[model samples]
Target: MPIYSSDSDNETMPRTKLFGRQRPIRSVLGGGQVADVLLWENKGVSAALSIGMTILWFLFEVAEYSFVTLFCHISITAMLVVFIWCTSAEIFNWTPPEMPTSILDKSTFHEFASTFHERFNQALSSFVDIACGKQPALFFAAIFCLYILSVIGNYFTFLNILYLCFVCLQTLPFLYNKYEDKVERYAGELTREVKKMFRRMNSNVLSKIPRGPVKEKKAR
Candidate 1:
């Protein structure tokens, strides 16, 4: 004999099925139109702010102060570089491959630091692509050479030497592909661990049941 009957199964069937046929074209089209409108609105706002900043920069430059002018120029240049790097990164989705187990088994801090370094390099690469028209090796070489020149010109002042070290570090991306791969692997592992921890905690709580007395047992 079956534990459940056909009528019982039908009664237990969900009011709303979990899986069903896809929606009609009219519904999808309406959703797409809403998304398009949102996108356009966001872009329009960004453009307006960008134009406003440019106008403000121009006004600042018109004021006859050398310090203000220099500050404005540097700030604007930095903003442009950041904006370009971010936009290019988003467009390319330049995420590297996961790190191998051999690499990630090392120190956690070292792995996380490496991941940060890799992201920084990717950002720099995007900037180089825009500046040098996508010749990565040449771009790196030019940057390295400039750092060398700056150090030599400054006669190895502490600040200049520090800057040169940073330049060399940034140029590492051009030399080895494995760095980005390792970073990605470490990041993935960390994410997996976090999710697993949360899941374990959730399961532990869910497995606990409230204690209650049965009617016959309580009566006894």
Candidate 2:
């Protein structure tokens, strides 16, 4: 994109994000491990997570196993393996699995907790407005949101939809970030063409429709 801006100074500008975004993608994604996995910065961890999700999907969707049952079986197997390893390590002098000193970093935990708190506070504010009848717009907006969710729920199970969204998050942003200029150019062209077509349609078809009320039956 930088090279494109240099080559076609009039056509494209430098330092522009997709959709004219203001913030960097990393900052928008909380600048964390999640962003790394999505952006393919840590390919090994990303691949492992992708493979794990695939296996889980196969187990739940193809094997028709309930989540609770599958989770319990997995937990039992992991515990058994770890217990055996720990027990046999003393006799065989095999190395034991190393434990992390901190499972979740303090910053990450605080950020996660604060996000929940903010969301709850926002929800409460909306609810209060609704209860006091202060903002009818909020009430209608809540209904619209519920209607949209219900429509989506008709087509997809919760897990299925969640998995599809996650897959998109993994692939779409990476591709867009990669081919930003081409995507933006094409998208802009398509938008202009669509608007042109709509205008043509309006002039040719919509204009011909009768607008005024019909004359009163020729004074019958």
Q: Using lDDT, give the best candidate's number.
A: 2
What TM-score fits each model? 0.19, 0.65
RMSD, every candidate, angstroms: 26.6, 9.3
| Residue pairs in candidate 2 whose N, alpha carbon or C atoms collide under 3 angstroms | none
Model 2 C-alpha lDDT per residue in residues 131-164, reported as the tens digit of each score: 6778786778887888998999998888887788
Q: Which lDDT value does model 2 have at 175?
A: 82
Ten residues in sequence with the least summed lDDT for candidate 1: 29-38
CA lDDT scores, all candidates in order: 0.51, 0.75
lDDT by residue (tens digit), candidate 1, 114-218: 656766887787776756657766677778877888778776544445544644433343222235446544555565566566666666765466668665755
Clashing pairs in 1: 99-185
| Index of the highest-TM-score prediction | 2
Candidate 1's displacement at residue 152, Å, is 36
Instruction: Supply the TM-score for candidate 1.
Output: 0.19
